[model samples]
Target chain A: MEIKETFGLMARHTDDVIVVCALGMSANEWWQVTGSEDTFYMHGAMGFASSFALGLAVAMPDKQVWIIDGDGSLCMNLGTLLTASGQGPANLKHFVLNNGVYQTVGGVPMTGASRSSYTAIAAGAGVERCYTADSMNALSAVLADIKKPGHCFIDLQVERDDGPILAPPQPFEGPEMKYRFGRAMERRFGIEVFGPEGY
Target chain B: MSNPTVHDQLVAALKRCDVGLAASLPDDWITPTLQRLDREPGIAHIRVAREAEAVAAASGAFFAGARSVAVMGATGLFTCLGELATLNLRHQIPLFMLVSERGSRDDHRIYQEVQGRRIKPVLESLDFPYFRITSTADIEELPHAYEWCRMQKRPVIGFLARKLLKG
Candidate 1:
């Protein structure tokens, strides 16, 4: 299925859930699908969205945290797989958008696209539960199990749409994006993301 | 009773700052502190494979309204400069870090000499504020430093000095 469709299906499950998106395709698609300021649309630090989401999950154990990571982004910091698995945060969900190419830079096929089994890699990295959803039906079939209480990794195989695929990203970035997301979290959760004078 | 060691002092300072979480990639100087943090009931510690993972994770905790810190060596700090600039600098996110201040005149490791010479200059160039904590008194000032980082809305490094760690 298309990246947007995968996001569309996952968007339905986002109530009370925190979404962290890797920069580029994952960020743009999730922003286009959700239009929510609350989810952190990371503008940089290419592969560390999973790390960021894991941190968010550990901090707020009461909330569910999911990261929309792409294949390109995942390769940049595969060591994160080890880090996340070691933390073993039950509230966190790892979702890789596997489109077999660097979809943002122009859909050039990545080196290990055919040979790399991300699910197998995740499992080998000590992730307790791993799933693969290659189609809408497959994703629908596994949503319940994947969403259950435990550390889970889901590799979502998405269509490699021709790049320069111009879906707009979340408009605001830098300090504006920070405050937008921080204030939204404070208001939504009644938590203190900033100090009294507002940092 | 014996005086609290530097590790103990630093952990106490973190507690005083209300820091409840830490993500760390250990350097030898900071390993004992990381081990102590691992057992500290009040602080949730995660051992990351790489330095940038710790930075990103600590950044994540900032949004959850919990104070957090990252611990690594000077070399590890060198590895994550891009993440520091792009994520923390770009977003104006506050991250508190404790790192081993390596490559001092007393430090014999030839490999660490480059890190000692370059780390502070690099931090200076980025305008990412950093403070040196060389004694127990300096450790006491950690809460103040942590608050300053939060107020500045950027990443700050508390470099644990070789004198203190080796003492």
Candidate 2:
């Protein structure tokens, strides 16, 4: 599915209890999906999100940690996959928006026309389950099937020609949106984001 | 007031800094300090599975925003160098290490004595700032060193000589 469609589906389905770690996407889209008022974004620190997410996921095991990553960003720290799998988290979902380019920094080709195989790599790390979606329909279908208790990767392969989408540039601080995400999810689904399992 | 002992001072400073996690392999020089740290109520002194695991656990504690210190003999400190380079230097994470020095003793027949002598030089080669604590008075820097490490976003090593901990 297209990036926009995947985001819309996530927004609709996410009860807000899931802490979406948004990184390496177009700035505007990243902010919108995260809707995080005050939080750290990689911004320029592309490869570090997964590392941070790994730490956060293990620390806050009760929270459903979702990582919104790009294929290029994943390639930057692929070793993180081994670390992630080493500490199995049933609640973490890793999403890779693979448009075959570093779309934010001038749409540079990432793999020199060679399709990156992240799903295979994730599966090899013992992620339990993995999926790749190259079209909007396939992306929607995968989102419909996100049952937890394992890690999930949705590689959303969009057209390289998708136009530029600009997000706000203000840096966030603290966990205001983290609280909002919890409140939003709790209001809708009666589940605590930072539950008793982790504080 | 001017002097107590290295064991007393390190234990007191670690309590003041609210250090909740500590791990170490045994050593004669650090043995008394380890014993004192073990009796402290606030600190959770853990006997680590290994020095490498101790470093990894310290990184975990740092991420949780807890003050964690790993204690080891001078010999094991050499072995933990790789972990320091990976988790502290490369990642800019702060880890406080207290390494107990070993002096010339008959038991030095083991490989650890050779490693003990090489600790400071290896740390220098890797550019990790270190301090030598020969007397209880030198222990005053413990808290300050921890604060500096947090502020600087790096690791700090305290090399406690045998005389200091023995007293």
Candidate 3:
């Protein structure tokens, strides 16, 4: 399936889930598909988005959290799968956009992409609900299961689109992004993300 | 204070700061404290495979309106400098880390020498603020340090001195 099509399918499945996007292609494409202020688009931290999403899931046990990760990012921190599995937060869902290359850095081929099985790796890491979808219909078929409880992993094999990238990122700086995300959380969940003095 | 007392005091201070979650990768110096955190009923302790995972996890917990901390050794902290710069620094997320202050005169570990000699200078170059905790009295300041980290909107390192941990 095409990367855009994969994102479209995932976007349609997003209900009230808060998304965390890895830097580069995942963040850019997610912004294109969903102009969401609720999502935390990582501009840095190449491989730790999954860990960040895991933390959020643990903190808000009642809320569902999804991380849109890339293969390069996943390879950078494969231990995250182990950590996620060990913690096993029931509200967390991990999805990897595997295109066999680093889509953001001018399509450089990623290591072990062709031969590696991310689902098998996640399964070995103790994530029991592991799925792989290579086509739009396959992805659509697994949408319902994605929303189900328990720590889950999905490897979406997509064809890298050489087309022009759409959706410019939010213009806000780092601190502004923090406040925006925190405020959105407070507004949505009626929780105090910041103190009374607004630290 | 004895070694166990210091651990008790540190954990109590974390509780006083309202830290509900802790993410950690163990080092010998901080192992006692991590054990204490693991046993604390009110705090959820997450054992991670890498130090950067702990850092990122604690950063994410902040957005969920949760106060959290990351614990690691000095060498582990060195391994996570890139993630610290990109994730915590780039995002202006406040992450409170309790790191074992290794490579001091009392610490004879040769592998830790580079971390001891270079960690502070690197943190200085990155503009990250840190404080050294040396004794039981210093444990009381953790809550204040935690508040300062949030106000600063950056990662703050609280270095637990070898002397204190050895108690």
Candidate 4:
């Protein structure tokens, strides 16, 4: 029911794939769950993490890429759905943590929170397959479906947290985040993310 | 040897850079080049919904070990400064942008005047390195420009002037 429970369900599936986390709660919660230096945690540019994942997916066709987005972040850049579906890279998956509130900057309710159907919006945006996971059982089923390769969207409904804080963000950020993630990519994939001089 | 037109030369230049991917959102002056990028065999082209997407997408390509570029109009470039500053500048990620250098006196478009007048000063304030490419010879800077971006670990804009784009 909690967002952490949703993340707990997701943590199992993230081991082999690259995850791009949208800044704020999504970034914080994902780190708390996984403690992964390999995932790219967006510190800013709130709405474009989906776009970042799309580019990574296109570049690394042999690998799977996941975007762990948030409701507010998705609304800010709804057009990403069109770009994702138009490109339709089978290696990518979109997951939105639909908690209906901005949990990080304090629990402010997101606009159109209760009324908007994100799955329908994704479908209209041309995503061929969409799913909604409102419970643990539903989330488990959807996660199983995504294990197979395809471009799919999942709207994850979880309980709202009206707390001063939920989970802390990863300690390393900005330049450190870049180097750590880039180095992890090089080590994991046997590729050169930086030049010989290490620039 | 330079190609006869703007798009031709830009495409050839990208090929020389071994750029494997490109993201673009078009403005009229940059439309042909965007189309040419769409058609390039070696480059995987993405047509994004917004200019910030192009900027973010190119930043994403870095982790894949792929050389990438973004294209947009001057006004479009203006739209993504926050993303550029926060995402790219904060992380010190390299991004190379091919942008329409609008707002020149010869352009004569009143709508573009604001973008032309403000874009450079804004870039200066952000301390982002940019080069104005006004002729075929200036195209040489693009390949080098991108390398400098990677070396500097920041956003670099190659502003394609009206003389280069329209001629």
What digit string (tens of lDDT, one per residue) describes model 3 on residues B1-167? 54557888899999999999999999998898999898899988889999999999999999999999999999999999999998888878989999999997889989989899999999999999999999878898889999999988888999999889996
Off by over 4 Å in 3: A162-167, B1-4
Q: Enumerate the candidates' DockQ scores in order.
A: 0.90, 0.09, 0.84, 0.88
Q: Which runs in model 4 stand beyond 4 Å of their true positions? A: B1-3
For A1-199, candidate 4 gives per-residue lDDT tens digits of: 6877789878888777999999988899889987888999999998999999999999998898999998989999999999988898898899998888888878898888878899999999998789999889999999899888889999998888886456888999899999999999999999999999997
Report the number of the highest-DockQ candidate: 1
lDDT of 1 by residue, A55-83 (tens): 99999988889898989889999998899
TM-score of chain A of 1: 0.96
The C-alpha stretches of model 2 lying farther than 4 A from their native spots are A16-27, A38-40, A162-165, A170-199, B1-167
In the range A1-199, model 3's lDDT, one tens digit per residue, is: 8777788878877678888998878888787777778889888889999899988988999999999998989999999999988888888889998888877666778777777799999999999699999877888877887777888899988887554345466666677778888899999889999999988
Q: What is the C-alpha RMSD of each candidate to the true structure, in Å?
A: 1.0, 9.4, 1.8, 1.4
Q: Estimate candidate 1's alpha-carbon lDDT, on a 0 to 1 scale.
A: 0.90
Q: Give candidate 3's root-mean-square deviation (CA, Å).
A: 1.8
Error of 1 at A27 (Å): 0.7
lDDT of each residue in A1-199, candidate 2, tens digit only = 4566667666665564343343546334656665643233443344545555544455446666667777777776676666566666676678877777777666777874374478888888777678888766776677767655676766667667444435454354323332343345445545443335422
Docking tier of model 3: it is high
Fraction of native contacts under 8 Å reproduced by each candidate: 0.89, 0.02, 0.85, 0.82
Ranked by TM-score from best down, the candidates are 1, 4, 3, 2
lDDT of 4 by residue, B9-87 (tens): 8999998888998999989998899888888899999999999999988889988999999999999999999999999
TM-scores of all candidate predictions against the true structure: 0.98, 0.55, 0.96, 0.98
How far residue B104's Cα lies from its native spot in candidate 1, in Å, is 1.4
